[model samples]
Target: MPKMKTKSGAKKRFKVTASGKIKSGQAGKRHGMIKRSNKFLRNARGTTVLSAADATIVKKYMPYAR
Candidate 1:
């Protein structure tokens, strides 16, 4: 059988950590920053882990990820 291909979109948008958690960037940090509050900006600075149920689905699409 042929090797599975990584989902390019998923590869760009989500990351798999060393421990197997799905890490993603915060939304709304790319544009219109002038209207956003400092708290909002600060909160958008970190990555978030996906829930277990959702991670299951994402892992299927990213079969090559660990």
Candidate 2:
């Protein structure tokens, strides 16, 4: 059988953690920073774990990650 292909977009955006959780960058930082507060920008600086429901879908796209 042929190998299953991973979703390219998901592979770029999501990462599988050591404990099997999915990590991704927080949203709303891409544009309009002038209107956004400094605290909001500061808080969104790092990656965050995906919620269980969302992680399930992301896992489907990255079958080999787990």
Candidate 3:
């Protein structure tokens, strides 16, 4: 049998926490920030846990992360 390769993109984007939660950055901060409010930008400035359904898909890409 052969070992599976981790998804490079996923590895860079997602993080598996010690408690097994998948954390990812919030979207919408890439551009057009001038139109956005400071509160929105402040709220988006950190990682958030992925939902159960999304975590399942991410886990597939990062088999060793578990």
Which segments of model 3 are wrong by more than 4 Å? Answer: none
lDDT of 2 by residue, 1-66 (tens): 999999999999999999999999999998999999999999999999999999999999998998
> How high is the CA lDDT of each candidate model?
0.89, 0.96, 0.95
Q: Which stretches of candidate 1 lie over 4 Å from their true place?
A: none
Ranked candidates (TM-score, high to low): 2, 3, 1
Model 2 residue 65 CA deviation (Å) reads: 0.8
Model 1 has an lDDT value of 0.89
The positional error of residue 35 in candidate 2, measured at the CA in angstroms, is: 1.3
Candidate that would win on lDDT: 2
RMSD (Å) of each candidate, 1 decimal:
1.8, 0.8, 1.0
**lDDT-based ranking, best first?**
2, 3, 1
- Which pairs clash in model 2? none
Q: Kindly list the per-residue Cα lDDT of model 1 for residues 1-66, writing each as its tens digit.
A: 998998888889899999999988888988999999999999889898988998888898899786
Candidate closest to the true structure, highest TM-score: 2
lDDT tens readout by residue for model 3, 1-66: 998899999999999999999999998999999999999999999888999999999999999989
